[model samples]
Target: MSDSPDDSGALHLKHVLAAAGVTDLTDVFAIRHTAKNDGLPDLWTASPEAVLAYTREQDSRFRVFPENPPRSWLVFMDDGSHEGAHRSRFYGAYENDGEALSERTELNRSFHIKASPLLAAMKNRLVVEWTAPRRWHRRGTLAGDFRVLEIADPQVIPFVGYDKVRLTYQRLKAIVDDPHYSRWHSALSAVKGIYLISDTSNGKQYVGKADGGGGILGRWSAYAHNGHGWNKELAALPKGQCEHFIFSILRVFGPEAIQRQVDEAEGHFKEALLTRGKFGYNAN
Candidate 1:
């Protein structure tokens, strides 16, 4: 948020933009921060964009793709207006599309901002402190509107591990919500090990493991996808009951670990939790 001069006493959007291949500030597109609003979807709202400065192409429209400004967006999330809270999220980054805009015009609205190069190795690592909060407070096609007054190279916030952590079912779903889960891939579903599912309402714990192709991510994805995860104990319950369950990893194993080893580990956890111990729910 510093105001240090950049040859003009004050840096405009064009100065920092040049670093990201966006020479013209006019070509920028921004979405109103809909976190506190009703029109936007849950993905746009619940996302940490309000405090993280994440750029999105979800409900965006453009006249056409151009060259100098690049067919990409130096997207800025509106930082003011937190539904009367009136504070800034103060985060920014380059949200470029790896694919050609011309090829994507015919695709779905969700397909607009792929930034494939940043998906794997980069993994949304372009987050930077572009400018001080309150700068891009409003939407406009003017020079100062979408301009970034500062740029601090960028930093990476990676997903470290799985042990010593517990999660609600909703949080588990949030981690693998597709576009914003690069950090989760390393810390979550990729973890294959014995897990515990506890019904917060009844205190029943179910033990399981994922030694399949998807590892822990693969196993939990079953729950995320269908709620029951094909378990007899879970299937007997009504739909949406899975959302009330709290999930946690009891242990982790290597991807190359054999199914028998995982099955044995799962058995150990099931015995430890004692599904028959009045608080357990293991049918096997």
Candidate 2:
């Protein structure tokens, strides 16, 4: 089946299949995989290997068609958006029955599948709107049920530009640790800037500046590694309180900008925002 176009003329999964030269779908099954369990890492930011391992585990959990399992499978990971409208990212295509079927257990009944080169280049980059949340798996003959979201850049996200930056502590830590967010690293590392660390849990804020040691990225990296980033006030916070901090840029300066300029900017923000008072987190 083909994806029908809407009035917006947005592309759909059928268009992607057509582009991939996958016209026939009789033996193809499409599946959406999510952590489903709490405390698991979000699939959107998880490492590729982790995503694959999770996918394999979910794929083997049950057999919808034990006697006539599909020969090929289309895999996706939940994008962690709105309940009904989030796009699911394509993980990979696979061939079922890659090995002899394992003995069936109450939960392990599906055939083992091996990754195929089909749409290999599109992994992480291709996202489709999976409308069938209740039915995570469906035969590929029903391709029209899913719509194309977009073919996004493979990075966790590109540099959102300095003024537009806003990151929670966990996301900031992920960007610092994950190589996939190299774009953010490269962009942030090139600029010296004034930043705000707001304790979202209590609404208190700290004004800080990045003038050296690898620029904004380096300064933020310190905060990501230790919630306090050596700041006396933040260090005094009870354990894990820093996890509520949200980082954002207040002003960006080039590498050529002098330390004095950055310091002055930081002072201005601290004074203007009353970030050094009892209501704020800044100690200085």
**Top lDDT model:** 2
**Residues 59-119, model 1: lDDT tens digits:** 2343332222323343433333333433222223334444334543442233234332211
What is the Cα-based TM-score of model 2?
0.54
Off by over 4 Å in 1: 1-157
The deviation in Å at residue 266 for candidate 2 is 21
Q: TM-score per candidate, in order?
A: 0.45, 0.54
Error of 2 at 121 (Å): 2.0
lDDT tens digits by residue: candidate 2, 100-146: 45645555443566788888878878888887566777787775457
Model 2 score (lDDT): 0.76
Collision count for each candidate, in order: 2, 0
